[model samples]
Target: MRLTPFRAFDWNLRSCGLHGHVTYRPDEEPLAERLHTSTPVGEAWRCLRCGTFALGAPAAAGPADEAPLVLRGRALRDAVILRLLAAERGIRGLLLLLLAYGIYRFDGSRQALRKTLDDYLPLLKPAAMKAGVDLEHAGPVRLIEHALTLKHSTLLLVSAGVLAYGILQLTEAVGLWLMKRWGEYVAVVGTSIFVPLEVYELVEGFTWLKVGALVVNLAAVVYLVWSKRLFGIRGGHAAFEAERHAESLLAVEHAAALA
Candidate 1:
């Protein structure tokens, strides 16, 4: 018996079963020759996606310039990148929402938290003194004390702002993950707007994590603007659509026919 080696996942075939094979009939001679052949039962057209021979007349017959069954080559690569960005946006959004919720909850129960801290501080402080740690001026304790002093209205505003930022992140995530034109616009514009803020934060205190985030956002903005032709850059929407049309499987077959 012969064994077959493992094959890399084929995105083309992933949807073929559910959507049915995409078979097209090109009336032109050389293109049709490349795409279809006669079988014992009938003429079998090649599926544009999986490249399987399906017995029957083509699902649609005409020129070979029809839309593709699935994204291929550079289009597929672009899709992967978009989804990776989307995932990052999604995670950041969730974390921000949780942070906002934590602040809100802290505002409500701060007194209780302080009482608990006071109750435990005598025991903790003795250990801290032995360990050369200052319980009164420790970073976490200081932050909690400062937060306890904030006005209710101020806490409310801060929570609301964080929640709004979180929602924006989630919205961008959905758009990018769907690979919509509007989503690309949202990501580019949103990231661009916040980039200055990120820079300001980095300037205040540098951290590799912040630097990484700044770089990623900058790269995403550049990619969406230039590669996706957002705004009027790179010839705008018409050129973007034309590129997709040109990158279709049928377009390649058409070029092959000419060759």
Candidate 2:
């Protein structure tokens, strides 16, 4: 929409007594001129003097064909988080979709699936025996056997569940990438649902990976609730809007002038 510049990094101009003013190096003048003129309307660029990053320029214009404007933040942290989460969700969705396809294929040709597993068994047996594992009673072996014995209806149910999960993950991925508020709410709820299970797993057995997962989930929940002000934290939705407004270039310019 607006495509205005955003200050992505803090600069202590007060220390240099320059306020918001900056002086670029002689060598940087040519590059600055190019950046000033040729930077795409919605592209990000850095301040020539302080090297701080900003998205769009003061006079940047949005194409009539562009989508509605996103209220990007002055700080880059939240943008980074949103992008990372989008990537994570997209990967998870893809994996789930692959797993669902595999399950469907296995159910469609049980004989072929069994034959494939049998063929691989010889190669796997030696390794298992060397590791002192009994293949007959191993969890993986039993799970495979159970899968083979599943009725068509059960297989269908399993495939449906996996497909649904994949769809949910993909939906969240796209929404978060767009920085939608609904996406944040969905992510917060989805992650919160697993917190108890993750905690129980940690209580059952302690491992660095488990602890790390728990910590990461908890951190995401806290960050969304506190930083994004979900469900009325701080001054609630009004405060959220006000904060975004305050981060705009005009607001920054006004503050600099007053300072």
Q: Whole-model Cα lDDT per candidate?
A: 0.83, 0.67
lDDT of 2: 0.67
TM-score of each prediction = 0.81, 0.66
Q: How far does residue 126 in candidate 2 sit from its true spot (Å)?
A: 3.9
RMSD score of candidate 2 (Å): 10.6
- lDDT digits (tens) for residues 1-259 of candidate 2: 7664544344343322343322221123344343333334565434432334445543332321121222323334576788898898899899999999988888889998789888997788889999999887887888998899999999989999999889888888887888888888888887787689889999998999999878877887898888889999898789987766544433223222332
Query: Judged by TM-score, which candidate is best?
Result: 1
Write down the lDDT that model 1 would get.
0.83
Worst 10 residues of 2 by lDDT: 61-70
C-alpha root-mean-square deviation, each candidate: 4.6, 10.6
Model 2: clashing residue pairs? 1-69
TM-score of model 1 vs. true structure: 0.81
The deviation in Å at residue 204 for candidate 1 is 1.6
